[model samples]
Target chain A: MVTEEEIESVSKLVRIKVADHREHIEKVRDMINFFEMLDSAGVEDDELVMDDVPVSRLREDAHESFGGLSGYVREYRDGYVRVPKMD
Target chain B: MNHSSIIRASALEYVRGVTSGEFTAEEFLSETLSRIEEAEARYNAYLHVEDGQKLLARAREIDRGIKSGQKVGLLAGMPVSIKDNICMRGSRTTCGSRMLEGFVAPYDATAVSRLNAEGGIIVAKANMDEFAMGLTTEFSAYGPSRNPWNTGYVPGGSSGGSAVAAAAFECVASLGSDTGGSVRNPASFCSVVGYKPTYGLVSRHGLVSYANSIEQIGPIARTVSDAALVLGVIAGRDEHDDTTADATPATDYLEGIEGGVEGMRVGIVDEMTEGADPEVARAAERAAGNLEAAGASCERVSLDMVGYSVPSYYTITAAEAASNLARYDNLRYGYDLPLDGYEFNSYVAEARGRFGPEVTRRMILGGYVSSAGHAGRYYLKALKVRAKLTREVADAFASSYDILMAPTVPILPFRIGEKTDDPVSLFMVDLNTVTANLTRRPAVSVPYAVSAGGLPIGIQMMADSMQDRTLLRAARALEMRRPPLPEVPD
Candidate 1:
């Protein structure tokens, strides 16, 4: 079971705010308990394959911009996306 | 056709009418726009409906093409709604979250471009669960889309708006993404045809990722043939998305669609049947009976791994989502507020705080499961389970069945806020529909019956990966025998 402290830690790590830590911890614990059913799947010594996609199908390295990056950026100046100042 | 009849017509019928000169594309667009305006106040199906004049102008160009003997493509002038997650050039694609509330897409999703190439007009952007996370559209930042069949009932989602748009005749058809039953759920709820093609069958380029590996952009339409037509337009390889398979040349889905399901093997999944709503179960059984009478042999088949599908699906999707959504950091194209004198990490945290509760919850859970210490225990274990589930489904298809039949949603649509407080109960609604996503198979939902309360129930059928045509063919057979459901009163 996940405690409120763990929930807070996870929330901060994921950059999300948990309004009510107690409620969130309870909910997350319930979800994790449900996910525990995966243990019974009994996958013994099965190698984890990332995906079925063949390497040959990968797109060649090309540099064609989708264009209008400034248009989508929330704050842009001097051909760069503006972010908050780092400490 | 008059305005009412035009709105009621199937996508194929509308296209045929436009091509045959029985009605101009302009006339069809006018009728569809008027229907959208009429339905918008009550249904809230669309986040953005295209400008009336712009749509009519596009339609008029198509009409001129027909007059001049130019080839107007398959969807010729038909109005189609797109789920908000699919980027449409110059349209606001919100994915029903404030995070992207002001974001306008610069390029069309590959599916949207293909739809346009086939002459399908962009009519509107439909609402959806925020980032396609929830089973109910009530999670939408734009507000919930009511089921057209019963205004009091919730529309199963995250494609609820697309389903409602198609069901309420706001558009001839709509496109939606199914990560874990998003498309099929709403289709069942709205009494329309919702199809999720095999993963990688359709290019995922420009679809806002929730869970990339498990999701596909699919079509929701008024009829099986219309859904198949839309699928043919959208399903193909794209140079942009390497995950897509080689392009399959477009074929006439309506051609020989009426071909009966004689000698086909249909298996009713025993695992899906147990613990489902009695009414929903009866509807699935009745659909099986109809198919059997239509010349298919039917029997019950068991896939025990189905019991683990939901947990595995949620874990895998959450983990992927945590990684995929890391791109949104308030510096780029999403919700942002200028905050001076803050560290970069703190600024990102503050901006990401704008994500809604459902998204935040999933992010937290995803972070927990994929964290360094928990990765091996939860994430890897879930992947192993996913692998086992995939093998189990493949084996079932190989041995006993051409298609597996189940209820699209185990329960009928419920009232708003009924299960909002309990997240687990809400996730339980996806029990029957998540198997296809987990196994990367093709599945479709076709309306089978209406409950005594007049709510719609859909029968779900799935085929093996890349067997989209087979699944759609079976759905078409069942669609032919579907009982006439009463239209939502205007």
Candidate 2:
């Protein structure tokens, strides 16, 4: 079983706060234990190449920015984005 | 057409009636909205139904266009539901998550745009699992969508609401995203036709991403023809999503779908059916027998890699979901939160607490597996297994079969809360469906049988990637031969 401290560490790494820390530790432990089945899958870590698209299939390198997008920023004030007011 | 028949009509039927002056689009909209008012209360199928007045006004516009012989698109004001994860310019795309509960979308998804251009009326936003994470709608932050067949039982999810909307006649069709069988699972439970198109067949530009690599926007409808009709509208190349196929396969998927599956080959995947309930297992066999009667050969083809498909699929999707969902840091596109007396990281962490338990759990697993210490043991190994599974499926497709058949789910729909506590058991329900997602194949669930207790059973048919047309034909053939289905009870 994973320690609660380990769960806290993993949560910090992902920047999530699992409310019932102990409960989630149990759930996540079961998930990791489920993942352990991959060990016997008889697969080696081969070079990763899958669903590959050739470079010729790539779109043109041109990039255009969305113009006049401030209207979309729900909290936009003038030209600046509104942040939560600091204490 | 009267109100009941208007509500019950299929997508194509609705279009034909509206176009040929049998029923106006406004009449159809009013009847459909009335049906939703009655049914949505029992099923909880819609997270947000569009404003009835506003929708009726749009329907009136379409009706006028039809009256004047304006260039009406194919759909002719067909009422359709969109799963909440797919953005429409003005609707709240909540994704069944409280974190995004108030986030109205500013742009339309490519699929939504296509459906609208073809005159499909967006009637409601269907419910789903939070972040499209769970196998049952029990994980929905709002509430579970019940099966139309039995309100006490679950509608299989995370496209549960989409299936229910279609099955209960609340909408003509629905668009749902399928990652690891979200669309087909619910369709199986609700006695609807759910299709997951080949990767890149439908553009995913505005879909709220849970697992980008494997997910595709698909249609859930009352029949195979309705699914194919919606697929024809929303499929094909899109400049916004480069991943969409450049040489579009066929925009008219409904064109030759009546082509019978005579002299076709189907592989009944042994891994998918070996553990099914006896009745479910028998249904797969019965479907095979039907195909055989249609002059198609049916045989068991075992792909051992499928045994490992679930773990690989979950692993890859978790990693992608963690990355895809990291943007909801409470700053850009999230519900409001107070930021007083806290540092940046701490404030953001506080806000992210809004994520439901399932999404949080996956993100944690995602972080651990992709972290440096565990990457070799979990993430990379899972990818290798995914590669092996893909190759194995590819070989089977190339060397042996035209379609693969299986029971869409391993068991009939359970009670809503029956399997929520057992995550692994819930994951196992996806066993028969994930091979299609992992291999990026086109798959469909055709409602095949009804259990003795009145639950639905769907027969899943899959084909090689981009063989959606062939897959649809096989599904239609099965639908034609199956026993007459019971109507969803009032």
Per prediction, the TM-score for chain B is: 0.97, 0.98
What are the candidates' interface root-mean-square deviations? 1.8, 2.8
Q: How much lDDT does candidate 1 score?
A: 0.87
- Write model 1 residue lDDT over B205-313, tens digit each, in one string: 9999999889999999999999989988988879899877775545555566777789889999998988888999999888999999999999999888888888888
What's the distance in Å from true for residue B393, model 2? 0.9
TM-scores for all candidates: the values are: 0.97, 0.96
Q: Let me know the DockQ for model 1.
A: 0.68
Clashing pairs in 1: none
Instruction: Return the lDDT, model 2, position B308.
Output: 92
Error of 1 at A76 (Å): 1.4
Candidate 2 lDDT over residue span B1-490, tens digit each: 2247877888888888888999998998898999998888899999999999999999999988999989778998889999999999878889998788567788899999999999999999999999999988888989999997999999999999999999988899999999999999999999999999999899998999988889999999999999999999999998777789877786888877888889999999999999899999999999999999988999999999999989888888988988888788676556567555767777777777778888888888888888887888888988898888889899999999999999999999999889877788888999999999988899999999999999999999999988888999999999998989988787
Query: By DockQ, who's the top model here?
Result: 1
DockQ scores for all the models shown?
0.68, 0.52
Instruction: Report the C-alpha lDDT of model 1 over A18-85, residue by residue, as the tens digit.
Output: 66665566788788888877777787477786766776778888776768577778678888877777
